[model samples]
Target chain A: MTPPPSATRPGAAALGLAGLLGLLLTVEVLPRSGVVSADYLPPTSRIVRALAVELNDRAFWRALGDTLTGWALGLAIAVVAGVVAGVLIGSVPFLRAATASTIEFLRPIPSVALIPLAVLLFGTGLGSTLLLVVYAAFWQVLVQVLYGIQDVDPVTRDTARSYNLGTWARVRHVLWPTALPYVMTGVRLAASVALILAITAELVIGSPGLGSRIAVAQTSQAVPEMYALIMIAGLLGLLINLAARTVERRALFWHQSVRGEAVL
Target chain B: MLDVRGLRKIYGGHGREVEALRDLTFTLDPGELVCLVGPSGCGKTTLLKCVAGLLAPTSGEVLLDGSPVTGPRPGMAVVFQEYSRSLFPWMRVRDNVELPLRQKKSLGRQRRHALVEDALEAVGLTASAGAYPWQLSGGMQQRVAIARALAYEPEVLLMDEPFAAVDAQTRAGLEDLVRKLWQERGMTILFVTHDIDEAVYLGQRVLTLSASPTVVQDELKITLPHERDQLESRADARFAELRTHVYAQIRAAGTRPAPTA
Candidate 1:
């Protein structure tokens, strides 16, 4: 929900930034000095120039849009489905008991294990990427939502019931507050997972995204352009993480875990 | 106004049956302030839960205004021991108090606001009405819970060791607050506690319960003046005598072996 306290410490960000710059310098020196062949690993300067060139290309922007569309759509579907399923299953004791074994059994299978099935069903398109992305992210949310519902205190539940609050009211006020922090936790994890699955689907299935562009560059022996596309993917993941954390902190400002982060 | 007739609660089944209450019978007339005193584990909580309609009895029933209570209804309200758990930390004190009233649909927005303000004023928490429960001290949090219950305006109020978690100083203040509220509101109150002095100090009649499988062992009537100062009432000879009697009953109950049903 929050960045580590070490990151918040005075001058820690500056020191981290310096460390990143140092790594960049080392890479620049290693490749230019031929310690690693330039063809295999381009120097930092060449990668940056290529990144600037790619930014000017309309094809690069389109690929970025396609990748983001897959991640966002998959994450949205997963969140809504997971929360509905989690709450419905959790609140009903009989339902929870009946489904417990099935959930446990299905949760651990890797999403990529279904890559063959995804390609067979939807071919090399956004649909193929979406299948993998949604599958990878749905369990992250469902498991956390279950944990949140279980964490609701018995006394609090009794308080709501004692007040004669109707079932819907109880869910809105009591259950929602207790489960929200966990749902945010689930979303954050899912966001990252969704991105990974999206790129993996595109690379393996030859879908139109940054991942496919990188593959094209690799096959064509355009080392600098390939590195540039990989950098763009890293930047996209970083931006998504930042957005997720911000949403979590804002939605859960009342929670203890997020309240402490506010002071920092 | 409140009647608990032949209440019995049995937990578990087969190999691990626990008969917490053999039978508990009591009545609180309108505006009656009765204290239920028992040993630490004498199923006081179980009894209170059943009376509040939060738990079903193994046998017998709780009646409010002569109607059977199958579950929590608008005519009844309860204050729990764990105030921190009872109050929603996500809501401010005012919202916490207003929540129950909001369910009443009959109350307009202005009326609901006024009731919330009045409850907060009664509990002397008007200034902290804007603060979250977690931001307040332990005693203040309990006051918020009391306000929430008060705002609901139940005809019969059930308090389950409501002051048990507070310190002695805070407990005395809360006891006086409760006394004032009962006198002002005229609601039938059944307060369950283990403290002998508190039982004697607060109740018109104190009922002492025996160990599990529990039953009412003794009843003592307190003859204190209507208007009482905590220090003066506590020092009175009659208060001492009544508390001693309840104390002895509790001690005996603690040592007595469970009888075979």
Candidate 2:
């Protein structure tokens, strides 16, 4: 059997640190050896030095805050609205049938395509960013919730009914339990979309965010700074995904994925 | 006590009326364990659903304690064959068992906990009360479903092919558990099954339904002793005789001509 998580996590962390150092060394060698252009991939050491300089700048911190706040607000709104709407639609076949064609029509339209319309309606600021983020996140989460609810077995519903479960009780006890894994899947998926849309809204429509900061660095010919900002955005996406996964694991420890893991 | 009179069910799709049950009539006394046996498509399931108030009869009435069953009453609980689908996958076993207790007006939290514990213990699931339904084997999950039903302390418990999905060994064990529970709780149980041997072994009386557009073809009273063991019950002369009698009735019902106006 494998070691306990307490021991495994520290070892995993060390491995990840080693991998980062190896990547830094390789990138450092590439530019000096003329193996790759420094302009495109600015050596990792230079990027880290630039990242240190940007960390002390008040404006960089402010922009990061603005982007993160917008992402958080947008994701929260999408989750509440999407899950509620999904449950309502999933539970009622008639409602799902009536609105399905409309959802399908709109889902394929990318959030990037909505930048101009959002800017027109909400102006070039947090409002536009929030709008795009919510739009990007909603459809994915909604579909997952619908599938989760739909996947709930008819026998469970019948069992709930036999127990004299009221409408609300059935949703709380039966429907929610059966649909949780699907909802978690949707949430994890939506987190990435939220990050992408937040960045895109900033980059395309001139909102104050890491994306806009990168644009500024690019215009100034600060290649290292630009690369560092891009790395920050990547890290942000990783953090969001990690956090969502952790929450999913804790909440659904009884779920199949967790149970399938060999116990210590 | 429950009564069924002139019960009819017709499947309306595919441009042809498929009558599942035709004027089925029967009466079940309180504290009786009755097994219903019939061929496939003989409306054994339809009758149980009607009696449980899950499905409305096309015509006629299912009376519960002299009143018509319009919807699920608090006095009834059901155990279905699909154990995996019958229990919520996310909830712990204890929560699943306690769910039905939530609907009972008289059960406070303390009382409910005691009842749930008792039911889980009775079903040999106390050690697994914290586990999820999916974590257990098929037989274990079925036991949890039974625990949920028994916890509710309903006056009438309906089981629809409750053990058909399990292996023969598990089926026999569950059959004995059902008999013990029925006697201990004094709850009226209407068990529907396609297995004649199972019907004979578990029930105090067996009700045989005719093929398609099912009606009660025969009702055989089990004169065997109450305390049952799987090995001895099958080998006993009385058990063999009762099984033979029920088998013959079901076979005859299977070949009988469809009723014509």
Candidate 3:
């Protein structure tokens, strides 16, 4: 039944890599052909050279650290707060009803819109970045946690209750495991949003990260360096997403949905 | 002993109130294995939930050992119909069986371990103890669910159509397993199912429930020998007679009551 067996299908990562290389080659060619000005969109080769220089600079390393710190701290706080609050609200009908509309209203308000207030409260520092990152990521985790708790199998819940498991015991043995996969999904989503907000806060408010570095290069007319910094930010987002996925797979090792996926 | 007294339950709030169970009453003596059989939509689940203290009755009460069961008592355990929904997929079979024992505060580590091992052994699931519930077959998963209930060491075990999802062979095996466990453990069991043959095979006594608004339509005391065989016992002429009688009764009681304005 095998059709010739002469050719193998390209894996997903190889296809993605080929597409990325194609895009890079186009960028490298367009600037030289005068289709795009070299002053604004530098050739990909020039951007790579600039990136090589930036990698050796201590200040660039420090800015990368700052970005990472803001993302990590903000995500940790948001996850803890979201999980606790979600469990409390989801378990109690009254609390869920009381906060449903309020969460819906608050969740839709963009984190960037809070920049003015953040600056007024914390100035252009880590606090400003933290404020935006936490605000943006909190809703990602909280909403998922709420949905996860809601999805707890009613039969299982009744089984737990009929067994006379105490409140804390029920939460630990039954509720937590059921909600864990959803929480992992929430964390993965939150990780991406947190990275975005961290960079945005640094760029718009000058809060010291790769985004601020890109802004500095732009103002100084270092077009190639600016492009390199933007590239670094894109690379950072990719790494965070990959890491989040890996962690999610490991944490939910026993979950049916995770276990059922074919390994690539 | 467990008692369900004049239990009535009405579901829905607004103008769409639907009566599920109306004035149902039953009792189970200690060490008795009783089967509650009914047709579909006969409020069997509603009745079982009320007895297990998972759902509150509209007009009556469930009393366990002379005490009113306002909520789930520590002395009861339940095996639900949907094994896939009832067992936590993330926990291995052993952990799933052991978790409820955490509620039995008097149980020490040694006793808990022993109980879990014994329960798994009883269900012939010792080898599958390390596997997740989802990793096993459907019938095996139901066995794990039963193991969990058995491990809980409850005074009364409430099973709501426990073997309904399994194959015919698995259903027969589980029926025999239930009878064996009841005989050995000497604990009360309230098994609910829509399968009349299953009720006749597994139960010492069978109670038939009518369609909603429901009531206990009839009760039968099984006269077959206590030691049952899936083949030999079912082949007995008395078995055919008993199941046929139950089938007739269930069909007669299957109609919905006339709507009273």
Candidate 4:
């Protein structure tokens, strides 16, 4: 049954904002009151001022754009590659078994560990960042897609087969719908991982992004500016996560989990 | 006509193999409505899957109109027991019903729409056609599954305990709906159930199956009037006799020890 619109309140949002303001006030007070070294940990007000200055800089915008470009491109490639590979491998028993060991072996190797190889192969450019981002993000999507495909009910498969649906038809009509929710979950996870790896690659490889900019500020002892850039990176992560969640909720409205949220 | 000749299905390999079906043999004449009744674990599902061409028999074959059924044929449709799983949750009721017709490619867009509407009307779900399967009641969802099968216009329909998940009242309603569909379409149907009364009420003939390593234990002609009512027909003396007869066979089959290799 659908509940009245007025019955649902924005209690969570109000509480979250209150908590964030309290945390920011504490951070601002700690260094200003000499509870911590202001040289290393500047007051929140100074960081905010540094953020305002950086926001107006043309170089800051270009670096932000480059980071996002790497994230988006790497995420796009991983999703397409993962879904195709996952569907193929998941549907075939022999292929699933053969690849299981290889997947498990490769999945655990940290993407950061491949930084040396990536730098050697692609130098300090978008390619280096993409290499790490794609490698990390690819696993998130591949595993989720595989799980999603496997989660398809056997009865549905049989029902499709009984109706004389061809391989392509079955995948389009049955398999895709059943696996979509899982794919969305995979994409959400991959989105976050892609951002993390993109920043890490830029930081380690001296690429032209916010991560490299933050590294430069730190080396020059621009503490407040470094904190501002770090805060921006954190904010970007939050924005990406929120956007992924919104997409998932909209796409999987028919799913029980999403429907349950609406009812609650 | 559909012929199942000595069908046997074994699961797993070598020492751990499970014999699901053993030497199962039967035939359905065109327009015949046959119900297979058995004890739990009697391999009714395995047999139905083999006949639907969804699974291969370890030995023997299923022949549909004199041709061996190697895979799913265009002339056959199946309504699986789990309606929730059988019907695509992502699609609307009408879309689910239209899917098989679209896949057939014989029906154009207009014909497909007419068939979907007709099937939904037959299942008394015309008003709910636009709703998703999850939005409907369990009985309604099951009806959508049936509607999907009906829209296919298959010569042979295989139903594996299709009404088992519904309540008694809903199950009775569906059983009547099925009988009405059968009489109207004159399509051959192979209905499987562990419920004795269901087999006796809905089928022209009832086939009883043995437990584990299942084989057809007995086949009995229902002999009930074609224009049977749920209240009157179920209360009939013949209905009581057939139900008792099938129940005794199932109980006997259940009590017997499974055969050793």
TM-scores, in order shown? 0.94, 0.90, 0.94, 0.92
lDDT (tens digit, per residue) of candidate 3 on B1-261: 998888999998887999999888899999999999998998999898988888988889899999999898778889999998888877888989998897788999999999999999999999988888888888889999999999888899999999989999888888888998999999999999999888999898999988788888889999899888988888999999999988888888876562342
Q: Which interface RMSD values do the candidates have, in the order shown?
A: 3.6, 3.1, 4.1, 3.2
lDDT tens readout by residue for model 4, B133-181 = 8888888899999899888888999999998899999998999999999
Each prediction's total of clashing residue pairs, residues at least 3 apart in sequence or on different chains, is 0, 0, 0, 0
Which regions of candidate 4 fall more than 4 Å away from where they truly are? A1-14, A261-264, B12-14, B256-261
**Docking outcome class, model 2:** acceptable
Ranking by DockQ: 1, 3, 4, 2
Q: In model 1, what are the clashing residue pairs, if there are any?
A: none
C-alpha lDDT values of all predictions:
0.91, 0.88, 0.89, 0.90
TM-score for the first chain in candidate 3 comes to 0.94
Error of model 4, residue B77, in angstroms: 1.0
**Residue B261 local lDDT, model 2:** 28
- Least accurate stretch of 10 residues (summed lDDT) in model 3 chain B? B252-261
TM-score of chain A of each: 0.95, 0.91, 0.94, 0.94
- Tens digit of per-residue lDDT, candidate 2, span B1-261: 899888888878878998888878888999999999999878887788888888888899999999999999998999998998888777889998887788776879999999999999999999999987887888889999999999888899999999999998888889989998988899999999999999988998999988887888899999887788888888999998998898888888888775652
Model 4: per-residue Cα lDDT over A32-71, one tens digit each: 8999999999999999999999999999999999999999
Error of 2 at A118 (Å): 3.1
Per-residue CA lDDT of model 2 for A77-122, tens digit only, reads 9999999999999999999999999999999999999888998998
Give the true-contact fraction for every prediction, in order. Answer: 0.78, 0.66, 0.84, 0.78
